[model samples]
Target: MSEHKKGQPNKASPEKTHVENTSGTAQRARLLERLQAGPIDTFTAIRELNIVRPGARINELRGLGHKILTHRLTLTDDQGRTHQGMALYYLSTNAPAQVTA
Candidate 1:
């Protein structure tokens, strides 16, 4: 056993790199966590995560290779206000596949 040089790969050990966001971190984390329990809708996502631009965020996630499913749903609100909106669904049962260029 010997000490490895800086910037040199340790052939014996695998390498891992983790990147985080300063702002969108919370939204991304929340989305992933909640997706495990069940699917989440656009309105709920925006309200709960305080996401100013959910479309952009969803696009970013899609770019990252997340298989998010979206569908239009007719829902009634707390006051019985009914409306049609898009619902974003993520299946926690499916494992995340690596994105390939």
Candidate 2:
């Protein structure tokens, strides 16, 4: 006689399951790790987090009373492809001392 239940599969066998980590989830995890480490400059943090430019928009509603600003960032990937997109900045805090073309 089998040990299995009359209507159900045996408990000795288990179903396999697979889970995948998404790019966005992985990015957020990295971002949180960085933030817990210390205070870091926005640009450097953004680069380290592997965050692409186009998605980093500043919330206008939150920036209405502050001196926030935005600028385009150009980056070259390891494959030598150039990407262009906007990076948000806080004018009073993040503005660089020197201007570069």
Candidate 3:
């Protein structure tokens, strides 16, 4: 059995020493909401949220036990030129159909 002195404070573990950000929590919640609503491409995230590293935020959501999937998209501009991009968001448990941009 461990004994504690009456006037002493217990030591905190290294795991308990980290502080979390309130803004990050809100951001993740919003990000998850957006993902659930529909596919959010990297461009959308950057444009809508003004996030420089949207993928990092998405990874944070993934670490919190959220099931997030990604699809590579190919888009064609008005000039009929094909361009490659990353679609950082689509939420679905079952396998999704092939996506084409």
Candidate 4:
């Protein structure tokens, strides 16, 4: 553990850390599965998959050596509202396998 000022509160509680790690892992797995089946947009991920932050999950998968691509496009939501500069995530066919240490 890194040392902080005497009055500073500890931010990394064991329970919070465990919950965050589990949530991130689950979200990344769900996103990867969805991407494998087909492309998923930000709105779809939020509405359908219950992933509020799809970009973060996608980045986590990329860090694990998955070749994920993003396509920027304008999209319409369920209420007919148009959103500009949206991202659609796709898994590339040439994604490399993860190397074991």
Candidate 5:
């Protein structure tokens, strides 16, 4: 017996939503750590980090004031298939130089 009406979208409980947010936070942390070591491609993020949406994580990092840069290029997958417009994310090394007044 439930009060949920038919044809209505199901909503996640607050606790479940918090868990999903925590998962996203963990994924963002992992992505940041990997980017520190070197550049990370979309395929590598998905295959290794288990992040289905690396771009969203990257955007979150950028929102947090991280200088992440995205480079677009072609990539070859394990199945010998080539993909165009692939994203390669890396931390920007060009910091603003300080000047004496």
Candidate 6:
């Protein structure tokens, strides 16, 4: 007579990996600090922050890609009238693309 037995390894038990917090208010603060440092142009700031889409927000401006739109600057006259003209380029480029899953 002979005995037969079977054993298997459990795949369900797994270890969890640690992940660091790379986003939030801290990152924004750092970005703002870099922007104010002096003689640093907008494009350089954008690149340093790795901000792909530079000015996607109202308070921001785009730099280094392609120009999609033009902004008209309005200057007020002594009589309280306004004049419109193209604003000088600080840096211009195409807008960055969004990421998707």
Instruction: Name the top lDDT candidate.
Output: 5
Q: Which 10 consecutive residues of model 1 have the lowest summed lDDT?
A: 13-22
Writing each residue's lDDT as its tens digit, candidate 5 over 22-46 gives 3776777778877888788999988
Q: Candidate 2 clashing pairs?
A: none
Task: For candidate 2, give the lDDT.
Answer: 0.41
Best-to-worst order by TM-score is 5, 4, 3, 1, 2, 6
| Candidate 3 similarity to native, TM-score | 0.58
Each prediction's whole-model lDDT (CA):
0.57, 0.41, 0.64, 0.73, 0.75, 0.33
Q: Residues 9-92, candidate 1: write the lDDT tens digits.
A: 432211111122225645565565566666666777666656666666667667767766665567776677888865555553
Between candidates 2 and 6, which one is better according to lDDT?
Answer: 2
TM-score, every prediction:
0.55, 0.33, 0.58, 0.68, 0.69, 0.27
Task: Please give the lDDT score at residue 82 for candidate 6.
Answer: 67
Stronger candidate by lDDT (1 vs 5): 5
lDDT of 3 at 80: 71
Arrange candidates by lDDT, highest first: which order? 5, 4, 3, 1, 2, 6
Best-matching candidate per TM-score: 5
lDDT of 3 at 88: 47
Candidate 3 at residue 36, lDDT?
69
What is candidate 4's CA lDDT for residue 8? 75
- Misplaced by over 4 Å in model 3 are 1-22, 75-83, 93-101
TM-score of candidate 5 against the unseen true structure:
0.69
List ranges where model 1 is wrong by over 4 Å.
Answer: 1-22, 77-80, 92-101
Model 3 lDDT per residue over 1-98, tens place: 33668887443332332223225555566567677677777767656655557788789878878878888777654577877975647776533556
Clashing residue pairs in candidate 6 (N, C-alpha, C atoms within 3 angstroms): 65-93, 65-94, 66-93, 66-94
Q: Candidate 6: where is the Cα deviation over 4 Å?
A: 1-27, 57-101
RMSD of each: 10.1, 13.9, 10.6, 9.3, 9.7, 19.5
